[model samples]
Target: MKKMISWNVNGLRACMKKGFQEYFEAADADIFCLQETKLQEGQIDLELPGYHQYWNYAEKKGYSGTALFTKEEPISVRHGIGIEEHDTEGRVITAEFPEYFVVTVYTPNSQDELKRLAYRMEWEDAFLSYLKGLEQEKPVIFCGDLNVAATEMDIKNAKANEKNAGFTKEEREKFAVIKEKGFVDSFRMLYPDTVTYSWWSYRFQARQRNAGWRLDYFMVSESLKDAVADAKIHTEILGSDHCPVELDLEV
Candidate 1:
C-alpha cells in the first residue's frame, strides 16, 4: 500500500511556523503533494530526509506554486501541461512511476465576482485534456486543491453559494465533464453520503462551525478505482485554512 497526502499549504513559509513540519513527520506519507506554496524558488529549503522534492514556481513571485515529495524517486517529472499559456502559474507537477503517473494540480480559483470564470473554463478543458493524454500511457492518481465543490453535498450552503466562485454552476459543470472523461473522485466514490470538507473560509468563524467546502480531492483513473483502499479528509490537522486530504492505494 502506498499512502499519499495532498494539502494547499496556503503559504509554505507561514505554514512551516504552524506545525507543518511536525505534521509532515507524523503523517510520514509515501508521497506528499502540496499546492499554493506561494513562494518563488530559493525562498525555503525544507529538510525532509528521506524524500526527493520537486517544485514548480510561478514567474510572478509569491503567487502560485506547487511541490511534490516522494520517498521513492520517480522515473521522470514534468512541471506543467506543456501549454505555455497555462504553464505560467506553476499550477501542476506530474511524476511518472513504473505503474502510474501522479499529478498534483492547483486548479485556478474563479476569483471574486466570477472575474476569472472564463479563463477557468479554458483551463478546465486544457487540464482535463492533459490528464487524458497521460491516461493513454498509464493509470493516473491525481490530487490537490481542485478549488471546486463538485456537488451540492460538497458545500455547507449550496443555495447561498450558487453564484460564488468555487460553487458557481459553470465551475460545477466543468467538474462533471471530468467525471464524464472517466476519472473517479476517490472520496465520493468510497463514501458517497459523507458530508466532509477540506477547505474553510477564514471569516465568519467558518472552521469553528464546520462550514466548509470539499475543494481538495484525490482522483484516479477508472482502471485504478478498485485499487483505492481509503480516501480521507484530515480535518483534525490544522495549519492552513485547507486541511490535508489523504489517499491509500494498494499499488
Candidate 2:
C-alpha cells in the first residue's frame, strides 16, 4: 500500500511553527504534497531525513508556492506546466515515478468580485491539458488545493456562497470538466455523500462550526481508480486553516 497526503499549508514557515513537523512525521506518507508554501529559494531549509524535497517558488516573494516530499526519488521532475503566462506563480510541481506521475498544484483563486476569474479559466484549460498529456505516458495522481467547490455538497452554505469566488458558476463548471476528462476524484469516488471539508475561513469560528469548503483534492487517472484503497480527510490534524487529505493506493 502506498500512502499519499496533500495539504495546503497556507504558509509553510508559519505552519511549521504550529506543529507541522510532528504531523508530517506521524502521517508517514510515501508521497506528501504541499501548497501555498509562501517562501523564496533560501527562506527555509527543511530537514526530512527519508524524503527528497522538490519545490517551486513564485517570482514574487512570499506568495504562492508548492513543495513535494517523497520517500522514493523521482525519475524526473518538472516545475511548471510550461506555459509562460501561467508559470509565473509557482503553482505546480510534477514528479515522474516508476509507476505513476504525481503532480501537486495550488490553483489560483478567483479573488473577490471575480477578479482573477478569466485567468483562472485559462489555467483550468492549460493545466487539465497538461495532465492529460502526462496521462498518455503513465497513470497520474494529482492533488492539492484546487480553490473551488465543484458542487453544492462541497461547501457548508452553498446558497450563500453561490456567487462567491470559489463557488461561482464559472469556477464550478471548470472543475467539473476535470472528471469528464477521464480522471477520478479519489475522495469523492470513495465517499460521494460525505459532508467533509479541508479548508475553513478563520472568521466566524468557521472550523468550530464546521462551516468549511472542500477546496483540496486527490484525483487519479480513471485507470487507477480501482487501486485506490482509501481516501480520508484528516481534519483532526491541523496546522493552517486547511487540514490534510490523505489517500492510500495499491500501487
Candidate 3:
C-alpha cells in the first residue's frame, strides 16, 4: 500500500514555523503534495532525508505555487499544462511514475465578487483536458486544493454560500463535469454520507465552529477506483486554514 497525502500549507515558510516538519515526519507519506506554498525558488531549503522534491513557482512571487515530495523519484516531472496562459501561476506539477501519474494543482480562486470567474471557468476546461491527455498513457492520481466545494453536502452553509466563490453554481457544475468524465472523488466515493471538510476561513472562528468546505480532494481515474484503500481528512492536524487529506492506495 502507498500512502499519498495532500495539503494546502497556505505558506510554506509560515507552515514550517508551525510544526510542518513534525507533522511530515509523523505522517511519513510515500508521496506528499502541497499547494499554496507562496514562495519563490531559493526562498527556503527544505531537507527531507529520503524524499525527492519538485516545485513549480509562480512568476509573481508569493502568490501561487505547488510542491511534491516522494520517496521514489518520478520518471519525469512537468511544471504545468502546455498552455502558456494558464501555466504562469505555477499551480500545477505532474510527476510520471511507472504505474501512474501524480498531479498536484492549486486551482485559482474566483476572488471577492466573482471577478475572476470567467478565467477560472477557462482554467477548469483546460486543466481537465490536460488530465485526460495524461490518462491516455496511464492511470492518474491528482490532488490538491481544488478550491471548490463540489456538492451541496460539501459546504456547511450551502444555502448561504450559493453565490460565493467556492460554492457558486458554475464552480459546482464544473466539478460535476469532472466526475462525468470518469474521475472518481476518492473520499466521497468511500464515505457517501460522511460530513467532513478540508478548508475553513480565518474569519468568524470558522474552524472552531467547523463551518468549512471540502475544497481539497484526491481524485483518481475510474480504473484505479478499486485500488483506493482509504481516504481521510486530517482535521485534527492544523498548520494552515486547510488541513491535509490522505489517500491510501493498494497499488
List the candidate 2 regions with Cα displacement exceeding 4 Å.
none
Model 3: residues >4 Å from true position, as ranges? none
The per-residue C-alpha lDDT of model 2 at residue 197 equals: 92
Per-model C-alpha lDDT, please? 0.97, 0.95, 0.97
TM-score against truth, every candidate: 0.99, 0.99, 0.99
Residues 210-231, model 2: lDDT tens digits: 9999999999999999999999
lDDT per residue, candidate 1, 178-211, as tens digits?
9999999999999999999999999999999999
Cα lDDT for residue 246, model 3?
99
Candidate 3, residues 57-116, lDDT tens digits: the string is 999989989999999999999999999999999999999999999999999999999999
RMSD of each: 0.5, 0.6, 0.5
What is the alpha-carbon lDDT for the whole of candidate 3? 0.97
